[model samples]
Target: MCSVEGAKKLAAYQAVDNHIKSGYKIGIGSGSTVVYAVDRLAQRVENENINIICVPTSFQSRQLILKNNLTLSDLEVASQLDICIDGADEVDCNLNLIKGGGGCLLQEKIVASCSKELIVIADYTKNSSLLGQQYKKGIPIEVSPLAYVPIKKRLEQLYKGEAVLRMAVNKAGPVVTDNGNFVLDWKNFDQSLDWNKVNLDLIQWPGVIETGLFINMAKKAYFGMQDGSVKVQS
Candidate 1:
């Protein structure tokens, strides 16, 4: 049986192997699982001598790219990318994802939009039949700091869920994203709700920056199973 970490690595390695190519610009997503993806990317660069440009989705991802000695670029430099290999907080049956557990949803979505294809890689634990079935963190919403309070209140009333500002583990207050926005985790909402419609509506709000509900964005996904196998879904 594959441990959780092993499964993550398996999915990461396989995704990198299958998606990445020389001369291609790539989007590096943020999160713990993405750490393993960077590791594999570094290995391939070292062994295969493949030259690729990395566009980081967060501060953490930039650090990973720098640490790995990978050539790092930005959207301004490489706005068009070949593909994006990312990890999802939760991947549903239709490949809809609940991302931004790391507070990088805004940038992640932007980079993914610039890319031609979005590839999601994850462990078995993150693979679910429904959006909130396995991941309990809820949908992450990036909002302007000045309007977070009002946005949170409005969203809570609109959707029956505990909408709380996500606090930092080491910092004093709310988790400020790389783009300097606050995050609200809408927890325990109706799972059967139409996320596509909700996401469209939420983004139109005054203070909302982005929502974690990724619909029709990902082209394919790789799930590393506990039984030491990889499952490809498209």
Candidate 2:
């Protein structure tokens, strides 16, 4: 059986091979799965001599571009990206996703929204029939430090689920995002709820910056199967 990491690599490489074009501006997302995508992109730059500019979704993503020797550009210069390749914590049949598991949701969404096409790469484990089916980390919501408590209360009041502050694993207190914001993981949502409406409502909250629920955003997805094959969904 192909290992999970191998599956990630397979999906990443497949996405790059299929969607990447010469002289494209790419949005590199942040996650363990996206690491393979960055590596493959670097290899493509070297072997194919493709003139591509990579725009990072976070500080971590920028570092990956540097480490891999890929040409890095900012969103300011490339406002309209050709494609954005990203990893999701979970992806449904409709290609809607649960991102922000790596605390880079704000920038990821901004970059994805700016791109012409958003391509997701993941292992089969992330593919699900519904939003919360596979990923139990709940919907991550980025909020201002001053508004986290109120926003959490508001979300719980609206959704009837517990919206808990995400704490840092290696450090004390809540997890701070690349945007210097706090994250609230809202768990136990009704799996059957209309996520598009939910996402719209959540973002309307006073302190909410962004939500992990990426509604109607992804154009395509590549999932690596256990058999070392790839599944393309659009």
Best by TM-score: 2
Q: What is the lDDT of candidate 1?
A: 0.93
Off by over 4 Å in 1: none
TM per model?
A: 0.98, 0.98
Cα lDDT for residue 66, candidate 1: 99
Query: For model 2, how does the per-residue alpha-carbon lDDT over 1-234 read when each residue is reduced to its tens digit?
Result: 889999999999999999999989999998998999999998988898999999999999999999999999998899999999999999998888999998999999999999999999999999999988989988899999999988888778878879999999999888999889999998988889998988888888789999999999999999999999999999
Name the weakest run of 10 consecutive residues (lDDT summed) in model 2.
152-161
- Which segments of candidate 2 are over 4 A away from where they belong? none
Q: What TM-score does structure 1 among the candidates reach? A: 0.98
Question: What residue pairs clash in candidate 2, if any at all?
Answer: none
